[model samples]
Target: MDNLRLNLGCGGTHHPDWVNIDFAPRQPGVLGYDLGREIPFPDDTFATVYHSHLLEHLPKRAALPFLRECFRVLRPGGVLRLAVPDLEGIARAYLTAVDAVARGEADADARHAWMVVEMVDQLARHVSGGEMLAYWRQKPLPAQDFVLARLGAEARLAIASAGSAPLPPDPAAASALEIGTFRRSGECHLWMYDRFSLLRLLQEAGFVAAEPVAASFSAIPDFGRFGLDVEPDGNTRKPDSLFMEARKPDAPAVSGPRVVQVCMQHTGGAGSAAARLQQGLSAIGVPSFLYVSSSAGHIPGVAVIPAASGQTLLREDDGRTLTHSQWPAFVQANRATLARHTHRPPGLELFSESETAARLSDIPAMELAQIINLHWIGGTADICRDTAFLKGRPIVWTLHDMHPFTGGCHYAGSCRAFEQHCGNCPQLGSTDANDLSRAQWVRKMTAYRELDITLVCPSRWLAGEARKSRLFRKKPVHVIPNGVPTDVFRPLQRAPIRNHLGIGPDDFVMLFGADALTNRRKGFAELRAALERLRADNAVSGILLLTFGSNTGPDPASLPCRSLNLGRLSTPEELALAYNAADCLLAPSLEDNLPNVVLEAMACGLPVAGFATGGVPDMVEDGRPGRLAPTGDIEALARCIAALRDLSPQDRALSRLHCRETVLTRFSLPAQARAYADLYRQLLEARR
Candidate 1:
């Protein structure tokens, strides 16, 4: 008998050699069925299964189970070929256009117009009618009209020709035709895919080997005969589609443990640390994967798995920014639970009662990982609720803050309720014995009962805090300061950097930065007070305070010192330059767990001055590389700043060398990675 082949979600495209299936079959001989539901075929039935622009239509929760069903039905060595629109490609195109406009290589108006079209046109266009196109022509955005006005007559003609056949002259008739087409077509994209995410999903579905393939290429025998790979005109149906092919193996088995590093986002302090660790592990001949909720750039030598996608932009109201794979209804329910707290803080908090997203436990990478190294997964991960998934796994949670041990609060300001049992939490402003904080603590207790978690603190202060926590009192905690790329942040000629920023060599520059400078925990108010004191005392005459970060606090003109606000720098290179240009780095954080800013600043040979709070003293040695004042002592902080300024040229030079050497010896990337690697091996061996 001829090999049985399947073409799932085939839409209007029918293949004679394959059983073409679609939820809405418009053509003859095509089988109609919901692809979200289980496949009806018996086990090991088909020699091949294929789908194009189909997987993204299913909700994230159903995607993997559907794939598993496909795996169950495929015969040994059967090929599964998939084609989906690439989110990364679209983002790249949008960013490229923006960059071109910034570089003056393209007209700003026209480029911006093209960028919006490139980002949204394909995803938001009317599926079966020309209504969207007509609406665009009638009321175009400024950028859109600019692009259209610049298009040549032939290009306009081609666009007109490509549009649907002329609508009926009667408005009612045209509306009917459009509605009819819409009813017959499957229109909305529920998710988006990039190469890394798609490949990871394929592996999760039990495919032994999966790799990207060209649109015209297929491993399946006589694939072209079915006319399924391309359109009737011999061009690809979706030009920018990402095609991947995977094959089933003869037997299924659990692979040996590898390293999977999980983080909330692939940026910021936590993200950078996780990425560096993965790179370090890879350098030492260990396989590593970095899984993030969202990412804009691909890390070299690390397989980056972004759970979210560009399609998220279309579903902004869904509240899935942190947990993209979650169901909309579940997100709503979770948000409702958070809303019950009348005094909840402004930022994100996950209080979901249940898990309704694609579980990481289902991913093959997680299954193969001997040790799941977690870093700053707060918004994207639910440790209390996801316990079932992590029950048997060995977990190494690197605490970037107090959130892991506390009741949803990233830092427990002065609340010691966590030392025993979290209740009447101050952060939540709840006095009830069974308030959200207490409930969360209870859930954590239950979840962690069977979990083998080794808590890693980047500072001694955080480790001590973890020991004081009721949840982690019995668990082992280790101090492992986060590492930085010393070479990248090494000392550069100060004068050149100052020249680049248009700063005078005579000016004494002080730098301050945070993800959000206005955040109360960052203590910008204290910095303000210290600056005022410095100005009053005339501590240093040519003083200039420079700030860089999102939402930098207050107006610069209001500050006592001459100030410059470099708002929200995008790259590490810019940050490094800023550090090099500065004479001293100011870190007035009220509470923190080994701030990466301090490390980067020190690595750049810049001394830091701040209150001797959590992790500050650990990095800033007293009377050496930098000075630290009493916590919350604005006057002392001002004095420390003055002391740093008063140092002679020779003493300052020695301090700079000391700062760089300290980072090189203690916080280098390889040292951090080696420590984690040893811990991983120990855990794996203990399990054996």
Candidate 2:
């Protein structure tokens, strides 16, 4: 502990004198560790430590414990140095620029714009890079000298490298939700800190004599020689950062309260939303756990619930004759009844209950959780039976659809029975007053009636639906849009992806995706009609249709254009490839709660042409990035698709940027996570 050094969250800087660790290391020998998590080192191990530009990414609640962790791993008399964006300095600059702008000074307007982005972008950016990145990458960058003065060497190097480097092969295509997860995994700033807050945090973390230092003047022995904070040109590595140092004071560390996000599959909208919330919470210093019916467990802090009776259950519809373990006798009995009762009209949208209840409440993680959030729990949790386990906890349920508030329907498409008592169910073609839908509704009422639960819906339409439901009409409902990682699903060079896909540069490629395109609500029928209209108009000659996901009814080749169906794009890179190669995405779903495709496509700078129904209006602004037609209006949809395809090159480029901007500002994972964290805090306070 006397002479050893540690560099935590070391992005690119490395020294032979120090042990380097980062969440995403850019160099060899730099350990990859989640920065806000517990440090993997013995107590009193290092003589000196440093972390740069990391403190602000942590939520204020988590910063103290993280500092305390640094204090604990550090030896007595050792020094801990940290650098963060100088909030006070930025505010002062912002004010000065405002005054200059008011006086109509030269470059003041540009300076003020940058100052505003500097103040707001990182904190508010839902997508990776956000508005600041957009600003930096602008051609003939605005206010170049003023920007360079504030951003210093780092920005210059990035801008220089970007300008000089050829557009290389994109290696970013990786995961389905890769874009929305960036800031939560440590790229975005969660909370800003000034000199005062910095000192207070260090002191609270059990440090002593916490004081400011210039990058060239660290208290660490011979620190100026290392060039860790200061560059060879004598310019600070991060000019806007406030560098500070404090002593260990022989202290220790611990962490804050815990949370668990309970949800269904990890692949769909609800699961992805729940997973992102957990990620956001984890980033901000809360190690929020995820409890799911089943998962790949790729996410940190995820706990896949054990199968029923310790045996993996093969879940199938009522006609299924095989499984690894037979579902519970009662479950099988219920499935048989549900099958017999469903003598309804065909073409209804459904991917019915996938799993039987697993007593996840008995798990250790559940017991340790101070709060439990439920999302898309259909078929996974027995709402009525699981009430006993869920009752004592602070419960939050996020509606992925109308399922939670309705009688067994994930979407009550054209069915308003849920608003009443669900009698005379049209889904079942039953006219009986005491039909199965009514029975299920009664059970839901009994389960939810007295339970203390808060509800969240991702779209305003869904929020209104939940509020209108008899079951949740009295429950508190909040609207928080879904978040997707923008980094993975970002703008890519169209030429390379098109060439690789054997597509001519002049071809108009329209992409469409969904769980199962055969689902009537996914609007494949409507989409086909629109495509046929384009064919009749001779607009399909240069068009290539790209479709993904399972299609059991009609093959994609049956569409009106030359078609390629890349069934179920399995990787983030693959999705990125599809997005980059396309002229526009056709999200023709008639009913959806903020479909991930719209968000992901926008994030990738691919405009979306879809029906202006459900949450589509929330995403697609006609003539901005994409256009929307009246739902079921094939002529209007064809016109809308053509409108997106026919944009002038200049307008198209701006639309692409605007598409990315829309998601970055509205549906970032961190923002959703912050909102949930705030809600959780309020609930916890009430619980206490």
Candidate 3:
């Protein structure tokens, strides 16, 4: 089969050098085939398999089995090339058109119509002949002219020739015959794909190397002989198609070392970030394991190892399970230390001076891993005590909040005491130079002084803060923003989502939430003041405020708008739907790293309006996605919200598209995984 090449679902395109197969024998030499069933070819029968815009025509359930069949039929080291319409590129182009229309750079009517056609016409256009043709025939002259403008010279000439020649008798009967042929043509797209989902699917189907390539670019020898990739004028058949290739491995490949991610609890914002990273790493062929103290529920693909069993340790060292019988004493010591801080703030953090629980290094998964990633190890683990045991291993500490660098406070708020040295702690209401906060700071500094550790901050703002901290000032800090699964949190129909949320079609919906709404750092009071200002100024009416998170704040009736309290949506799916149900997300955080709410909302195609604090400006691009007011400026915040409300429909649509594109381009899960993979490789190389 050295000279053999297979072109499945070739449609009307044919090549003499390749076995062109399609469900319908569209050409004289084409072989009749159906991709829904297994191919008739023997194992390892072809040197290369090429298919363009074919896989999406099959049902979603048939995608994997069909790909596995392709892998089965290909010879060792053989290539599989595919080209599918790029959903991301299409969405981005639609956004561009919407922006142009909003700016008056393009005619709104024509551009909007073109965008709608580009988005769904391929899927909705009937394969049975005259449905699309009939619709086009009924369009006005200007609309028909616009369609002709998008066609190539050859296609235009063909259309002109056909128009001049066709004056057939019984045109209705002729159309009926053509429609019958078209009904059997198998030309509808059943499923869609973007680069990330397609890459994961290819890897799952057993392709050793799957990567996207430029259109008309291939590694196959004499690939152009098939004439499958390009049009007669040498341009690509579809300009916006995602061209990709995968190779069957010649031999079994060596796998990389497993990643063991340690976090406090497998829930909350930090827990979600860690879990998503683990999922992403696993999808990209890295073995990932997660060890947590407690879990909200079962997490898929992560092996959750509980660090403690009540007061007993669960770790095994030297084949002996270490039991923390003195854990009760340690808890009492922790309470005594916390009791010293008499003036606790609304949201207070207190850490034990020392940890007497199971050492993380003694865990089986930790011992087996090549890398130890620490994330938000507050109540579950101790950095001062546990990190000392990880002297020789590569440790990657991901800062979820300020706790890692600060003196036990989750956020410093207006306190810059952690920058120079933790002393006269305000959060703990201590005037002593060596308070509990200072002691914790000193312990952490001494414990991690010689450990091999690299710090990863999810936002530039957080990284900057870490660089200022005394404990992590000299540590290697890398800024890697948290990622969201765009596939899961993608844009959904707003009308249905809003209807499901019991919101009126004309109401302006705004989302405000966090882990705890009453937490001072979350700025719920500021949001309430801004809403009141908006109402007093009569800047917005018919407003629906959707507040989520723990119901710890003031009553919803206190707000000036009709309000709904969702009460802490715990899952990403539920959160995604909530994001889609709203027009914009309001994040009035006084202090934050990279808030996941912004990323989640943007991924769901919801604009964000908030203060220009922390990493808010990094995610929300002022006028593009939404407006950002100066920090703590309630009136300015109110005006920003009103501005978003007053935006034209086209501009709002543009903002929604831009928000989704921001996540798709920068904060995708695959991008985060790839960044970590690079960092891991670097760390491993340095260790050697």
Candidate that would win on lDDT: 2
Residue 433, model 3: Cα distance from true site in angstroms = 1.1
Candidate 1 lDDT at 55 equals 86
- Least well predicted 10-residue stretch by lDDT in candidate 1: 306-315
lDDT of 2 by residue, 1-688 (tens): 2487888887778786787777656665565544564564444557898988888888778798789889866778899999999999999999999999999999888899999999998887655566776677768888988888887788887776555544422325535455456556566788988999889888888899899998889789898887888889899888898999999775433254566676765656677777777777777776566666545324455544433233443334432212222134435655576678667777776524333545545342255566677887654566577677777777788878887777667788888878888778777778898877777788889978768889988888999999899989998898878888777889888898888778998888999887776678999889999999998998888888887775443575577888877777766678888898898999888888888878888999998898988878888888797998988899999999888788888988899999999999988887777887788888888877
Per-model clash counts, in order, read: 0, 7, 1
User: lDDT by residue for model 3 over 250-345, one digit each (tens)?
Assistant: 955336655778776556788889988988887887766666655544354443332222333333333222223344455577788777667765
Question: What TM-score would each prediction reach against the true structure?
Answer: 0.65, 0.61, 0.60
Error of 1 at 28 (Å): 24
- Model 3's lDDT to the true fold? 0.74
Among all windows of ten consecutive residues in candidate 2, which has the lowest summed lDDT? 318-327
Arrange candidates by lDDT, highest first: which order? 2, 3, 1
lDDT of 1 by residue, 28-72 (tens): 666544456455343455788899888887767778988887886
Residue 386's C-alpha lDDT in candidate 2? Answer: 66
lDDT of 3 at 96: 74
List pairs with backbone clashes in candidate 1. none
Q: Would you list the rank order by TM-score, best first?
A: 1, 2, 3
